[model samples]
Target chain A: MVAKIYRKCGDIDTKEMLFLPYLRYNQSMRETLLHYSFDDSSSSLSASGAWTLDEVERLRTLLEGYDKKLRTHSPETLYLDLSQVTRFDTAGLILLRDYIRDWQQRGITVELLGMSEKMRKLYVLIADAPQAKIVLRYENFLAEIGKATLRTLQDAYAYVQFLGELTVHLLRLLLKPWHLRLKESVYHMKQAGIGALPVIALTAFLTGMVIAYQGAVQLAKFGADIFIVDIVGISIVREMGPMLTAIVIAGRSGSSYTAEIGAMKLTEEISAMRTMGFDPFRFLVIPRIVALIVVLPLLIFFADMVGILGGMMAAKWELGISWHLFVQRLYEVLALKHYLLGLLKGPFFAFIIATVGAFRGFLVEEKTESIGLQTTASVVNAIFLVIALDALFSVIYTEWGL
Target chain B: MSRNVIEVENVVTRLGGRMIHEGVSLHVQEGEIYAILGASGSGKTVLLKEMIMLLQPLSGTIRILGDDLRTIGYKEASALRRSWGVLFQFGALFTSLTVAENIALPLKEFSDADATLRDEIVLSKLQMVGLKPEVASLYPSELSGGMIKRAALARALAMDPKLLFLDEPTSGLDPVGARRFDALIEKLRDTLGVTVVMITHDIETIRGIVDRMAILAEKRTVAEGSLQNVLQSKHAFVKAFFKDINV
Candidate 1:
């Protein structure tokens, strides 16, 4: 049936034969056609068509063909005749605008002639319309530097304010210990701390093993195999254990915090909480920060023990060092200050990660894109702060001769 | 008489264990404004989605522009889709794109027009929708409710579609804005000679704009015809829907 219909409607002549009388009776019918001619001194283009979307492709091709020919002649003036255009729409108007603008840009004087009243109204509506222009201004090097410095200073100021607010909340919670939501804090601890244990342990163990294996190879060359214990024991206790754990938690939990709070903000649930006479800091931020601060040191302590055990295994396998000797050397060389220094940084790292994540979350705008951007910024900021604070702690520990 | 631009026959659609439409059927003639009216949760939006081919009915035959939807191939369906445009309830403009870019999207995808022609078309479309060209640079978030609706209408009309579908075009507008939008729809129908299918419960729109209407009730279309024909309907739900309105 479709094939029969297609065969009957195959040609323009056949369609016109069947429908011309009806179209003529319709009285408002517009025939689709294009006629153009160019003289040696000037050019004239005439279009007679139902200039709508249905004829857009054909009109575009016809106009482009004429454009090529007109350019070759380099005519001083061009006349566009639209008197025969019985019907016109946006598509047709736009094509006409493009043609006139192109000719004007080529320094050719173009005249639009004889448009129907309706077509003229549409043409005037679009042709005389005001469009917004975007202008880009170039900046000097010093100006760019000044802008960057100002932006950085603003960000620092905002971060300092966030830290001050968080500290105030923490102090208030400490003063009124009963105000802490213990159940909510424990739920967050299970999510951000206990749920993270396996991956953290695995990564820490592998890091310690890699260090021991690599150190054993070099220590054996100098008959300094026993010193491998000092390298693994001191580094794991003083730096690697706490720093690695913090980095893992930042990637795992920091992004979650940003996404959760950002979604809540988007849905206006955060505002609802505020309207209900609940302080968002006391209800939301306090629980997350307190849970992270309490659980991070315990996680680091667990990582320290597991990482040293992994180092001992690697040392025994590669250096022929007995487990008893490795343990003895670890106990002999590792001091109380090394463990204390590493564990001391855990709470600060947790505070920074939780604060940055929550801050970025609250900063999210209403758009869905803002959530993704804030989540990415949360992870990056948390990890960077953790590393920077770790370095600062190292400098302080060294200066104090611990 | 104009041919049926859209013919939906005995469509049965079930979504998520709930029967949305059962054996519901309606036909919209060419160059006519057809409105679908229903109470809340009456599956009017779902039926519109089915008509637009965005959602498939469990069982039905939908013939659009004389082509049976199920028999058409994917390419043919896409080409058919280009022949029509849909305006969603909340604008549904691409959040990341500026108004001009959003309007230019369908043209850029379907037409081989040059960049300058496309931009000109964007400006023309904005003008046609009664928006200033300066609005072309604004994002959807920057637009007020009425401006967003106008921008979405511009985007829908970008390709000069022969058929236009609107879902609640005047729901969130002031009375003056709603009247203006109704006038715009009437002007578009007169100027473009296009068929329009709208889903709305706005009494003023029903009285002023729609040429025909269908009332969905009890998981099916209960009454369909001119506003007067529907008002004369003896169906309980249909009568209840128009009881409070001074139509």
Candidate 2:
């Protein structure tokens, strides 16, 4: 509906039309009653209108113009006349309060004059009400550093406690294998291990091919191209196969674990299980951890085979080394100790991924957003810990003169 | 008597081969507090959603505020939407934004008010819904069940809508809170002249606030009138519904 600005000109009604369809003004037939006149000598402004939401736009514009004038004139006192306001709503009350506040902030004393009883009550309700205060305290650089240090220490403490509980649960399950849900463990095995096989094989194969191609380029310069087989075999069996498989699983199965259990946490399903006399760790965490531990070694062995096959194919293609010759050279240089070293890290990697994923899941609160946050944290923490553990193992093996 | 603000005629809706609503028709007048009541699986929410245009009826016409929803263009449909507000069952406040920002969203998007004016409107809307200005800074997750409902109500009223739609406004609230909410709705209707369409099964709300009601049964609106009229309905399901509520 169109907004009509009404002006009362000496007992004659005049209306000015303006298009404001959103206003939906229904009481346009009310007497034309809005007029604001300024008295420069007394520094006073008088308004007469309905002053409701329908006229808020025009009112704001008028008030803004008056405020600018007052700022230039440097008025010490401003009087507001609102007795002629025929109607008022929350919007009108807020506008009046804002104007009073704006003038008061500029060292002008605002005084209300000739307000009706209803207007007086409304003014008191809005203007006299205490304004809400928001206090912001700034922290110094040292305080920020101290806060970061304390948070890190607290997180470390929580991690240790989580590890302690997991160890206890694992030991208890070992003492009673009959209590384990074999069906559930197999289900998780298929998900975490079998479902991840294609990606793991693809990553390991590509890494092996890249290593062989790069090694061939450097070795051919020194007439040492035949040693490409040894480089591919030793690296795949000792490091690349296990590390790549673990990283892939951490991205895939670790995130799924966090999301699933985190959703259950949100629905209070884990609490329900505990209330039913079930150990949540044994029911939820132990099965997942056991399944990954059992399947990861086999997955790493498969990755090693695929990686070797990829290297052999690249070797034959790049250096004219036949598959038979490549196999023979691989056997001569790749020792059982190197292969065993990679296989041995499988359970450790699996333990870290499963525990970290479940730990993050259990950390989820009762909010839907927590599921997404914990899932992201699960993948990132698992991948970082896996790499850190791999570096630790490399340092230990190098110091042992292997 | 006022003109009808909502007129749904012979609406038929199906979901997954199940007929949720069949030939259901109802109308709500202006400045009315109309309630839609139904038992479980009786399509109360489905009908509400259809009226809001979230879901389309298979065959029907919904006329809201003189606009036939089926034939309206996107601009016209949005303009019509701006004339009304909806409150979902769970107070579906955006979790990422604080209370004040959520209330300011419609104003910021639709109106060209400055930041200071927007802030004043937000505070006034909060106060209109009986919420303190301090509650504006808190996130939805930090609010209690009742506080969330109030905050959602404040957001719904931000645009000064002529029609307000509420879905189970008192479902999760305590009895005292629910009564206070019903009183607040009644007060808003009286003060703002807003027409309200609510879907609920709360007997207290039906008795205290609703001016008229529709009972969905037998895949249609079997009864539509004042609470007393619906309670006096001869239909078996309507009788059982009110009897089940001990009303």
Candidate 3:
């Protein structure tokens, strides 16, 4: 029957190469092609040519078709003759092994024949090994939502724990200031505080000018252009200056903190510190937090000064309000409480940024990509917490009638 | 009767104003496991890097698979690169991708084979390197030192290249694991018919499976050949290196 199929094609010399019903030679030049002759009545199959990596797809399709046909026919036994296989590799062998396993599962006795010594060794090595299932993880929408919510809660808990540890370490260092890494603190101040000066000044200056211009437009309609000083002074001193400086520091230094600590963690430097009897929190976290705490208030103060200067300039240009009159109005109306209130939020914002950044750094896994991921999370979390804390401060201050 | 798969001649390399390899030369024949041996600062790695075209020698010629490394075009160079595989010392598996994806990456990029076929090839290569199929979904960071080496080897063999380059393949493994690694390399060479070129300091690996070797010392090839042929040299480094191993 197999020979008759080839004879019908009439492309090859089937009579010369054909041996029997179960042994028909496939005279083709493609070394990777697999040809099989199946004797339907006896359930005997003879396959020839190459069974290698290149023939994986074809071999799979052929074996799958045979699997379906075998299921329909319900053959008691399947004899697979591979004696004429010209080439073989692990790819081909694995596919054959899997189909054979499937056939056995379907109550068909599969017998492998004409196994070479090399093939037998390969068979024992690969076939006898314990197979592990490939698990691709998938979750429905609700499960994903639950996992995300849990992750967020876990993150919040971890952050609180990190803050508690930081406070303990801070108190310990406060008792012995000599144990504090003063040099590292100074270095971080230079990086996060001094290095951030120019950008903060520029952003705050522009923000003050925009506010002055917008407020002048509205006040000029009411012929109360002098009130622009009140709007710019109160907003920049009490809200804009501190919040903008914190957001900028969150993006710049907070990201750097996470990346630096995360890289150190990935390289096992954090572990090395612990093994060497150095408290990583006191050594790494405290220096950054102290630096930001000391510097952020100063940064906000400087931003307030630059922002008031910008408001003076915009007021003079847009509303013809003299710089002297603006200063007089600022001194009178923008009370010391407003300036102190803005400065007061500085330490809280700094603590949030530094702690969130360093805590995320500790969460980095061993992979380099984890550094990038944690750094991004650090910046985002710092900014979010900074804004939320500012809102809380506003609510508390308003309730207290500050 | 095997042809020369790699041939280096009178190579000179200078890095950072220091003469690393004044004049070095070596050849690796097809179907043989060749070892490049030297001390820490002897420029053995520099020579290997030069052979693989990562670093060019100041003056010399390296003919790999009959193509001159110095003057080869970009198209020809990439084509030649696809015909061989390289395994770095630290496994260098992409941290972002899983072990299976790392192994299947080259197949996906270089071949027209679909995802299913690529997955099968990945499993087959994993089995070839004696790894459990379950390890396929694991990341490089999750693997132990030995498993990382095995996974990296599987990835290197993904394209079924004619040549395999290994850098300190058994450097970090325990004695038993190192011996198993050497056996696996030997078996792979026999089954896959690939020429193996490796840089190693392991005396056991040098004695166990190396068909031929070249000892690099003091900026040149001090000795080159089979164990008997290399032992014939009276070089001080050669004698000291093999003194403890009684092969």
Candidate 4:
């Protein structure tokens, strides 16, 4: 298909621009409409893929002018990311892809950067991707990397340092009697521990029953169906109790702490505290950490008992055994080490939750969206760290023969 | 008459490549109500916050009450800020605490200043702003718009701070309320003998109470001194700041 190319300068070879092989301007500009003669009823219906090679060249010429205009007029460097172009089977995409490549080959600086998976695949299909030399107006690869590097470096470094500071604060509170803040400590326990009991118990109970029901079906085949109590009790007491409690605390109280601090930061209330002679660590963080360390274990203990009972109920019903037999088998298999192991993990998990939550909150970058991000990051990081640490502890304890 | 008490010298502040404030230097004198009167986002809040070292300058010095604020640590900054009071743009009185508790917070936190001392201070401050001490027990959620402003002003003055930083004091108040607010500010200044730095776009606030004005345009000081001088200047941006205030 042939299309007309608008030439800005005289004596330019039309054949060199190979991308000029397709596309049609369905609607003509005033000058083009006046110059081009068309027959009456040349189509009452509009053209869909009625594009010609000349029209494609015309588009290229117009787009080149736009590129020049952009460079001269607007100071902002545009990210012409192609990710929005979902699908392509037409020469329109090929023309754009080619122009970008041609500009690159000629060492013409591209102020615009593109990002498109579809375009990327298409570009790779046609050529080994155009190595466009981006003459960035403030957004070079290094500048962008430097930007991301600075942001990530700042975010990660600040987060790590903040976590360290929080650790020191927590250690200081634990070691020194002076900064213990007993009253605030009690208040935090209520916030992080006691406040979370209902949800933790409910979740643990359901989880235990689910685990027991599954285990009972397997054990009944071996005529060792009575052992359903062992799996549910052991798992709940050693792994699920502490881990689930920690996750619940992270999801609930962790998000709460992040949001609270985030809101304070957004409103400059935290800044107000700094101006008012109060260290946020001492006033805000110490209380929450103390609360979590003291309270999360107690919640886990409660969850453990509730979970075992729930498991016993599931086992008794699934195996058609008496409740008393289930209780005997549970106590027979459940060792004090399992109880101790779960309790030990509780304080560690609580520390991670409170530290991550408070750190995420303090790290909130003073905006509306930062609060949400901090809250999400706090929960995710807390859960991930909790599960990871639990796995490590399990391995360590198994080797230690605990 | 520049009774200069605060000296902002070569202050440069930037956030992620864009300079929010640059080479912004200005002064506020003792006993005079200085206004950083710019059409909002002229870095008025940024400048105001720098007075008490809320936002640290990237490269400059701010002398508040004859002491350089930048050299101080968190403790020192708080101690310096304790002597001054700030009214936030959002009327940031503690929503959790009652109006009385909100006003009494600084004193309670920093001082063992008794409940009796607090009650007396809270009552006096509330009365100073035309709010009854009876309304002291009510939470911030319960207060009306003008009341919240008065309460916020009352909190700002509760500590008897020698320096007061108010960001758009009459922003949410109605015309009558805003006028009354301006009057209240005047009365408070006269009685307290405190240096005030107000950032406001309210024309009435300017004409009525402003002793001197600084206009921030193009990320730096466009004009400084009396309201009349800034309004009359050949600088179109400064002129537009005043001209647009009425519009």
Candidate 5:
């Protein structure tokens, strides 16, 4: 227990300072190592020196030793003499509190003495602090599996609901064309379409060259090198051009859409727009979707031309097939249905990328890092769905005997 | 006489090809709450950043804890940095870490204190900042606006800083929360003997807690002193700033 003494120094002492005895280190040494001594006659443990963070390790070792000594002896009362403590901090207070608590719990009376006013205030602050029970959520394997399954189901349901809402809004905008954000739509077109031209052209050209080079080698072995034109033109127009373009756009545009919209959501811009009676889907989502849908087919058409051109170049270089012959053969054999079908898949792929991107954007939570997470998920989900749809198209084409 | 803990003399700052502070100067004495006040674009935050060494002034001498910022080496700079703590406007807590971990991060990096000691320190800091123990296990995202600021303050005080820097400490808090925050800052300064330098626009906070202040205007410090000392200034910007807020 502390004595209520007022010192005429500039410091003000509060009533809580009485919770522990106060001492000022006017005559004490400027610095001392934290050490404890047992006064055998008085049966009291007296500690001296500066008890602070820098001396925390020595204090811990001494306390552990003291705990062992006390348990073996089982003293009726424990006298803690902190009179010689020159300085103290929260770390020192914590260690002392824990040591006293353990002894008191062992049915021994612990009497704290010689606490400085600063230390007592700190001690009371720590002692009276509400113990917040930390709740750690732990689930067994089966419970984790069940929770994951439920989360997946909820996410699927949300995605489907989002799709339905987007469809209704799209139909409404179609009926009233004046409501469309044409300027934003055009801006996105320039970003996702025109900006992507160089990369798409490069990848498609490389894919066609690879296909033609491989086909020419194989056809030359069978003495049917002329058939390389059919292989290059058919594969590039029917599959490679559209597939390559879709994959590239999904990585570039889809991720950007998710990041942009997710940031806007994080900053509460979307909430601000909604409060003003503007649908976020109409203002933010639809323009991106419309831009992708309009430009994807155009990108695919351009990819097809570049891909065939690359294949013609590869054919001429590898198999000595003249450009005239290759073009002439492509015109005769590359069916209109193949090109039209590849172009048709563009809109569907664009829809998948744009919807998934925008949907994931809306999923961003209040945390700053969630934008990165949603963007990554958007790109991954768009690519996966595009591939799945392309496989379904392949199955339909085979079933219909196309 | 109390010593000057931080002294900024004729600091000249330019950012992005624009001059921000032409010649700003001020001094923060030991064991006092000093405020930096300015208009919206008057570069109060920039000046705070400069003092914290996040931004270096184009030409100036910033002496903190007896070391010149312009001449301090990397090793000395880090050692000096550990002696002070900064509480940013938006809390700036790591989103991935729990409140406990955020508070303990500096201790973990700087000291060999064991896990039990670290946990105790974290709990003590939480209590000191008037935060409940349960809040420690929660992430930064789970916290309310006031709780976020308190949690951030706990983390800032984790190192037992000799000086504290706060940027718009009460900007987002309600009036009551702002007042409580002001009281907390005063109590912490009294108990810890730490000098505080803060940038705040809250007139209530300035009137209630600030011991001395400097008003920044016209790309430089136009007024400096206690509230009454600066109130006598004839500067137009200073007059406009405190016109509505009667002491």
Candidate 6:
């Protein structure tokens, strides 16, 4: 296939095989014709893209090919088919009309086999007197049952795949041994979970201080500056702790899972597991999930504590509140519900992070790009799901009076 | 100790549209080094992978040690895993583990041996592979390409299994190092009474020590037996290959 393309590109090395794939105008379209569709199955002698003038140049060039090739060889029916085209603007009009004239002058019976309505209308509009006389092969849009059926099947396939992967994820948690793969899984969780403690702690603490300072300044005018403690404590424990923990995990552990698995896949290390009579999930996935399940809640606990303490610093100085009252109000605001809520969401968040990370890794298609793509998608998708689910929980918990 | 006839009966593996290994099969006798040889994409590694149960065949069954891996559960599969050892192409030595710890993986796994005994065994395996006891403290990244291969071999030999598998045992090595490593494999195979199977594209490794050679080709690929039989194959692709090498 590549060799056949080299013939079209006029003996260029693979390096010179530059595809001006993102064409914007006629020169770009010509560049694409010169470099892009060299081995494409769909391209006839001519295919057009991006711009009308380029499309016309492409048509004129294709028309010239018949005259040039047939002048020496025997003549055959040449088609000015636009059936493959899906859209058209005005400039495609003048080029086609001039092309038709050029073909007639050369005594070639070049038939316009297929024209979209828009293309035909554009040509007719260009000829203004309404005598473009271009033939239009009308195609029924709804009658493309084949493509529609394929698309519907593809969508259904994607949906079924989602359900299948979901089931696999659940079964992996339920059925895989907690005793053995714990070490391997926890090994990663430590790097991703426990090891990230210092930074996450500091981040939460600084964030708490910042939020408290802002809250104290606002509350001071209202003679409620002391309330900054409640704000920081309640917010960090109930919402920020879980939210921040997940986001941190997504960035740290999630991307690590993706890159680790990506590199494993790249190196055939996953396949090595298969040869060794071990499921990759057993050796790699199960362990990571179990460890995170065990550790994420703990990290969230620490993050909450750190953030609340940072809040306390602001409560003491800016709010002119003593440490005792600040601690008291903090304790008052932090109900068991807040702590339970954050911890309850721990395993769920871990599950999402692990699944998204592993799924992205699984989604890699053996291209160099898949490494960055998988890692980026891992964090983005994990964070998105985390935020989306958090909103759902907020709605549910509020309605449930938690 | 036992002759494991790893029959890959009518195996077929496909990824999307391409048929990677079509109806590939091979048999290895006890105390024999069955070398699977091919270029990078010729599915040699895939064929060897089946021996370890890494790849699933779309069709056919793989019988290792009189058990079908596909029929077994995870625990059962893992249980049977100790019977064979695999040396990955890049050594796949746990970068986190030192040379001794890496080699001790299988021994620590299959045996209920004490730590001191395991450490002693690790030392012995390293010695057999011509590594000094002091080198055991170094991690995989610290080792040279040749040392990594040896450490991986030591790990594979840790269990003293009935069968051992190595992928590209001498790849990325200097010629002298490659030769020395090949000699170590030869020496270990003789003394250990272990069935050895290797995936290699190294012609010199094949010539020097491979007992039987599986030349992975197209549909007619994976012809295995004595090295002489493969060298004299009449298949056009096989014939032209040997002709190029002037074998």
DockQ for every model comes to 0.31, 0.24, 0.34, 0.01, 0.38, 0.01
The C-alpha stretches of model 2 lying farther than 4 A from their native spots are: A1-35, A39-59, A70-93, A100-149, B244-247
TM-score of each: 0.86, 0.86, 0.86, 0.45, 0.89, 0.43
Model 1 segments beyond 4 Å from truth? A1-33, A37-61, A64-89, A98-149
Q: How far is candidate 6 from the true structure (C-alpha RMSD, Å)?
A: 25.6
Candidate 6, residues A276-394: lDDT per residue as tens digits?
A: 88777667776777777778888989998899888888777876788888877767776787789878888888888877787677666455666897799789988998999888888
DockQ-based CAPRI category assigned to the predicted complex of candidate 1: acceptable
On DockQ, who's better, 2 or 5?
Answer: 5
Task: For candidate 3, list the clashing residue pairs, or say none.
Answer: none
Q: Is candidate 1 or candidate 3 better by lDDT?
A: 3
lDDT at residue A190 of model 1 (Cα atoms): 95
| C-alpha lDDT of all candidate models, in order | 0.85, 0.83, 0.86, 0.72, 0.86, 0.70
Give the Cα-based TM-score of candidate 4 against the true structure: 0.45
| lDDT per residue as tens, model 1, B1-247 | 8799899999999999999989889999999999999888989999999888899999989999988887889988998899898999999999878898899899888876666667777877887789987788888889999999999999999888889999999999999999999999888887667799999978999999999998888988899999888889899998788888665
What is the per-residue lDDT of model 4 for residues A151-198, given as tens digits with 9 covering 90 to 100?
Answer: 767767887898788778777767876876679888778777767888
Chain B TM-score, structure 2: 0.97
TM-score of 2: 0.86
> By the TM-score metric, which is better: model 3 or model 4?
3
Off by over 4 Å in 5: A1-32, A39-50, A70-79, A83-87, A130-135, A138-141, B243-247
Q: How many clashes does each candidate structure show, in the order listed?
A: 0, 0, 0, 15, 0, 8
Candidate 3 per-residue C-alpha lDDT over A1-402 given as tens digits, one digit per residue, 9 for 90 to 100:
353323333432221223223222234323433333334333666667777665566566667655665665677777888888887766578678877777888787888889887677666655754344455566999999999999999999998898888889888888998988999999999999889999999999999999999999999999999899999999999999999999999999999999999989988999999999999998899999999999999999999999988899999999999988998998889999999999999999999898998999999998867888899999999999899999999999999999
Model 5 chain A poorest 10 in a row by lDDT: A13-22
DockQ, candidate 5, vs. native dimer: 0.38
| Residue B40 in model 4: lDDT | 57
Misplaced by over 4 Å in model 4 are: A1-156, A170-178, B1-247
Candidate whose TM-score is highest: 5
